[model samples]
Target: MDPLLLQVLAAKQIPSIGDDAMLLQESMVELINSNPKAGWKAALPSRFSNYTIGQFKYMLGMKKIPKDASLSFPVGSHVANSNLPAQFDARTAWPQCSSIGRILDQGHCGSCWAFGAVECLTDRFCIQLDVTISLSVNDILSCCGSSCGDGCKGGWLINAWQYFVQNGVVTEECDPYFDPVGCRHPGCTEVWQTPQCVQKCKSENQVWSDQKHFGVSAFNIQSDPQSIMAEIYTNGPVEAGFAIYQDFPLYESGVYKHVSGKLIGHHAVKLIGWGTTEEGEDYWLAANSWNSGWGDNGFFKIKRGTNECEFEENVVAGMPSPKNLNSALSGGRE
Candidate 1:
């Protein structure tokens, strides 16, 4: 084994595996050795270099999805004008860049659905209201009812957005991640938990009168590149779910596709924009909740329109309400 690869294994505390680990190692080595001309580059050795395929899948967060497949098509309010840019990047799109500098971590919990929804919700609300209230992921995870799945045990993005629009989500100051008590607290390295959902506000004090910030509407986008782009370009950052493959974790930069590694599970992410690479490969720029240490400084670009990893299959977006009081959103024309 390469010394650096061995070092990464030790650093990540990769568990010893039987034949399965060996097989995964060989597959990774083969991909590295072959060096296909794929647009993205995989790591020669990274945190996941020594992990078994099963181990890789375990690290992936997403699982079940909602059975309901209906999406509000023609997305009445978000029809982009002829002036829509062929290429757009929400991260730098002037006032539309509500999600910039706000990358979040789901900790060790499988709360990607919550994180993705709230982060995008926060951005959408901020863009619509010009406010900076950080929405609570914990609230959605704990209070979204039985159908939204168990807290930190994984859930559906559709249910998450639906909950946000209907019930509203409180600020981070209200719920504050995992509360350090739930076994699901990602920072609780020694203890893993299913987490009991309990809503808290300001050290148990009522700094504000309300329990949540809210939006007037939320909807799923058509499973196509054009609709995905129009939704984000018109609304703000949108939430999406994609299948996670073994090769996904090692992504360093550039447009990503399944170059190696087997499929693990699904993952939720925030879709910010779309652009064609200099190589003419179309890609979707998204923000992941795995922290800045993960990929492309906490963000990633994936092959677009190809339904790579089943990404475009389940795109969702929502509209934030005007100011805490009431103001009007221009592009979000309702």
Candidate 2:
């Protein structure tokens, strides 16, 4: 065991044998459970234990850019209120939209950037238009080209939203996700190639252009807690990009805060709602693309209000075009 590794584990209160503190060695799980201050539960998830910290970090693929002046949206009075609930979950709020609760895996790619955007957009279509449709994440990942970023390797959220307005994306039923079961099993590495862009639909009956859905506008929200709550409360869910630390993958339950481990990488997830714990810690309920096997059944509660991991700073979303929806409902393509 390296002396520095021991020091880090002690400082983080995670019992370890001089390895990456975030790596789920068997000893760390017992140490994690005994340490009350650690706040979250740790498990040697057999799926996660298969890879080293470096390999696991490669699984994250959200590449963020500076906030554009033209892209920010004002927190409208539609959702503004002083009496916001202490806890709110989008799944509970919009039970009619099954997509709100559905979790998808990004697989062996760093396509979380695309997953976060489409997941939120899929929920928003149901929430805003009273129309239930699962948007295709693959459409953005494979086809958006250099404008969206290098597909699979990573992507830009704003560019994705813009692509929705400019080029549009097909339904999940048309294209579907590329690698649904790739990254979950043991021995998986950074081998997910950027899927080739295909303009055609998978189904014989669905025309690629007719299956396309569009966004009205792309924009960012105010980073304040109330503003974020108002956005999710009014608009369903929003995509949030944040700095991920090593202790993140070990998160099983409780309001997560950076406890131990090095800065791994930046990743994105969908912020579905907000809440406070029984212990009175405030948190944002988020859905990850790492599949349900990881953390609280594919969801996580992270420290809110304080902008832990800068989660609040990079929130972005857009509205589904009602014209496109109306056209689709009327059996026409706009």
Candidate with best TM-score: 2
Clashes of 1: 1
lDDT of 2 at 122: 87
| RMSD to true structure for each model, in Å | 7.4, 4.1
User: Model 2 misses residue 41 by how many Å?
Assistant: 0.9
lDDT of 2 by residue, 121-145 (tens): 8899899988888889889999998
Those runs of model 2 whose alpha carbons end farther than 4 Å from true positions after fitting are 1-22, 27-31, 67-80, 185-188, 326-334
Displacement of residue 283 (Cα, Å) in model 1 is 0.6
Best lDDT among the predictions, by candidate number: 2
| lDDT, each prediction | 0.67, 0.79
Model 2, position 151, has a per-residue lDDT of 86
**What does the lDDT read for residue 73 in candidate 1?**
31
Model 1 misplacement above 4 A: 1-34, 44-59, 63-82, 95-99, 179-191, 207-209, 322-334
